[model samples]
Target: MRTTETSSWMKQLTSSSRQGRHGHALHLFFTRLCLQPSIHGLVDPYPAAVPTALRACAHLANAASGRLIHALVLTRPALASDEVVATALLDMYAKCGIISSARKVFEEMHVRDLVVWNALLAGYARHGLPEHALVLAVKMRGLGLNPDRVTWNAAVSGFAMAGNDRMASDLVCAMQDDGFQPDVVTWTSLVSGSVLNFRYGRARMLFRQMVAGRAHVMPSSATVSSILPAFAGVSDIKHGKEVHGYAVVAGVEQEVTVSSALVDMYAKSGLVHEALRLFDKMSERSTVTWNSMIFGLANSGHCPEAVSLFDRMLREGVKPDHLTFTALLTACSYGGMVEIGKTLYRAMREECGIEPRLEHYACMVHLLGRAGKLDEAHDFIKAMPVEPDCFVWGALLGACRSHGNVELAELAASHVRTIEPSNAASYLLLSGALASAGKQNEVFKIKRSVKRRRVKRLDGCSWLETS
Candidate 1:
């Protein structure tokens, strides 16, 4: 009967893996099963069982619950010795922020299988330690452990996320040379790597090959997701349409992953109307779907629409994350809605309990400065919890240049000089401001400063600096 209930629990677990569902149902089911005292002695034969439950804990980020599960696993002497349980134990520990414990489990797993290695690699990869992940992959290869799809995919995506497409490309070629046929995931990883490294043309070429070859392999939702960002980079509406046609032919348009990609592709193409239209037509929309629309609208100059959609999202009880507010604030900036931007910025902290990250503050500064409210923008910068970076000052200086405000230009120039004295743009802008004020001597002085800065930057190229 306990086994029956466990089987039932597994069904409920996998069936509702999608986000925004009743996750608590699965959580409760696992809780009931794990709490029973009789199951405590079932560890030896049921070592595989607790790991699945712990996975649910990881997914929900229930650190306390994961700890409880980890404790339970540790108490089972026979279960603790199982390799499968040990790997899941590491996964749970990593997810729960017990990285040290996870490392202990990883080290203890003698005769670790590919699954164990992949899990550890994925945990390291997700925690922003791609170097550790790569090291583990090398160790696995050295151990004569033949890697499977999951291992290759994790390594490739790990490199892609780390912004090292060259390494990722090398991995793909290495996989191919080892007689490993590239799958949709492998292709997606390469395309994603290209996009991250700003090699959109190469991404496009690979994408085209995938389509033209009509290789028995079908593109996964991951493949579509990876290629969509590249389209945004290249602004290739033609190729985007072809991909869209393929998606429809493949019957994956209804898949949330595919839909999210489509939304992003249209949005990045500057076809705001088309993007909005596609968004409306989607049968289901995830947070990612909404995020893509919001970002696209904000970037494509539909600032008002983006803000309105944000409000609609709140009304619909959809929780907004950092990316969500970033998009909303960008909308406010692009629309020159300084008052609205200020209110939104405050609401992020006061009402939503979300702290304003750097991007949000940048957008806020951009809003105030662009609207000729330079003093207020400067005050906001001074009052920020974090130190203002060069981009923040650059935005203010750009605004000064745009408005031809000599006083603000000088102040912004001073800040820019501290941040990047050698930047030719600052000198040029200072000269423009001086010229705007009809200070001919000051303009010449700024020009001389620029020339001196340029000459001082080069050691061997002195003869070419006569200008």
Candidate 2:
């Protein structure tokens, strides 16, 4: 009784999801076919539509809508019993971070195929439970379900993502022993995991291994994107350009993620012009792409251009994310555009509905502090909805030091020391402020206290006197 063929409605759903228009897909599922019926009567949508809709929910991480779809599936006897529908439901819950709910769906399935087993195994593995994934794999074998490449890759990805390179490598060997050749995904997982956990050298080595045909796997778009960030982190633009060339040779240079990573690598490596050129050439841009371009412009002191890019993004109907606002605020701060920064801060909350995070508040403090609005910056800190962190207070302290406001600098330093007792930056800033104010005796006292406490200043924790 399972509907196997793709219907027109299912095609529409699939197309939207694949195109990354997940919100439109969710709307179609919820309003027309999922929650409400057509004007004709109680409409039974094509069984395939359910899976497509569930995948859309997975992409959007909308578990509530996924549950409603689950309800609809249950009411349809055919869909409830179909293995495809059940597996889709399990994947939706898992991808949405509801592993327990995914487990429930798995247990309730009347028939479990290899696909079903892989779904649950991946749910455990990718959700930071590789041990459980391994255990599940063993149980599957005990039940006579041999693990496939997909199963092995899922386990590898899980361990890699958790930063356990040793365990992930062991899994790779085990999979090889089981006669499943490791592919591009396997190497990419290792490279991505190394980068995610700050093992940049390991990531670069793995990427080199791939390029040298150590595993007979050509670097895929994903592999390129995964390794680019490592080079970007270390500012190794030499290798970054090499990878950009590799992307072109591999024919994935134009892929959205790969291109976006290229933009980020260029920007972070101080090649804002190169980044912008690639950015402008891109036909499709994701939020990461725009964030990279904007942040690069801001950091490179092209503040006006950064704001202009942001406006272009909005005019083109691209939604601005939290990082977008962060980049804009950073531009305003660097350029001393207080009025624009304040207006955008208000718009971020009122228009975009993105609740201001700590970084956003810190950006505001930095903006005000940079513009010499010392009293206003202090007032903003006092009125913060959440408790101010060291960074927020640190911004004020740096500004106070620059302005030689000894009293305010003392207040700011006290708060920083209270929050981060080991941070020597505050002491250095206070001393610098005292020096600026011509209070050499106070500066000597501060330096003596720092020495007595045996507070070793972390590398690069220097303060400049501006008074």
Per-residue lDDT tens digits for candidate 2, residues 1-467, read: 12333355566777898888988988877665545444445457677678888888888899998998898777777888888888999999988889999999999988888888888898888889989999999999999989999999999999999999999999999999999988999999999999999998899989888778557688889999999998874347787899999899888999999999999998987889889889989999999899999999999899999999999999999999999999999999999999999999999999999999989999999999999999999999999999999999999999999887889999999999999988899999999999999999999998899999989887763233233
For candidate 2, the 10 contiguous residues with the lowest summed lDDT are 1-10
The TM-scores, one per candidate, come to 0.83, 0.91
Q: Write the per-residue lDDT of candidate 1 for residues 344-415, one digit (tens) a residue.
A: 888889988998777787788888888988888888889989987777877777777777888888888888
In model 1, residue pairs whose N, Cα or C atoms come closer than 3 Å (at least 3 residues apart or on different chains), thus clashing, are none
Angstrom error of the Cα, residue 312, model 1: value is: 1.2
Q: What's model 1's lDDT at 151?
A: 76
Give the RMSD in angstroms, all C-alphas superposed, for model 2: 4.4
Quantify how close model 1 is to the true structure by its C-alpha RMSD in Å.
Answer: 5.8
Every candidate's lDDT: 0.77, 0.89
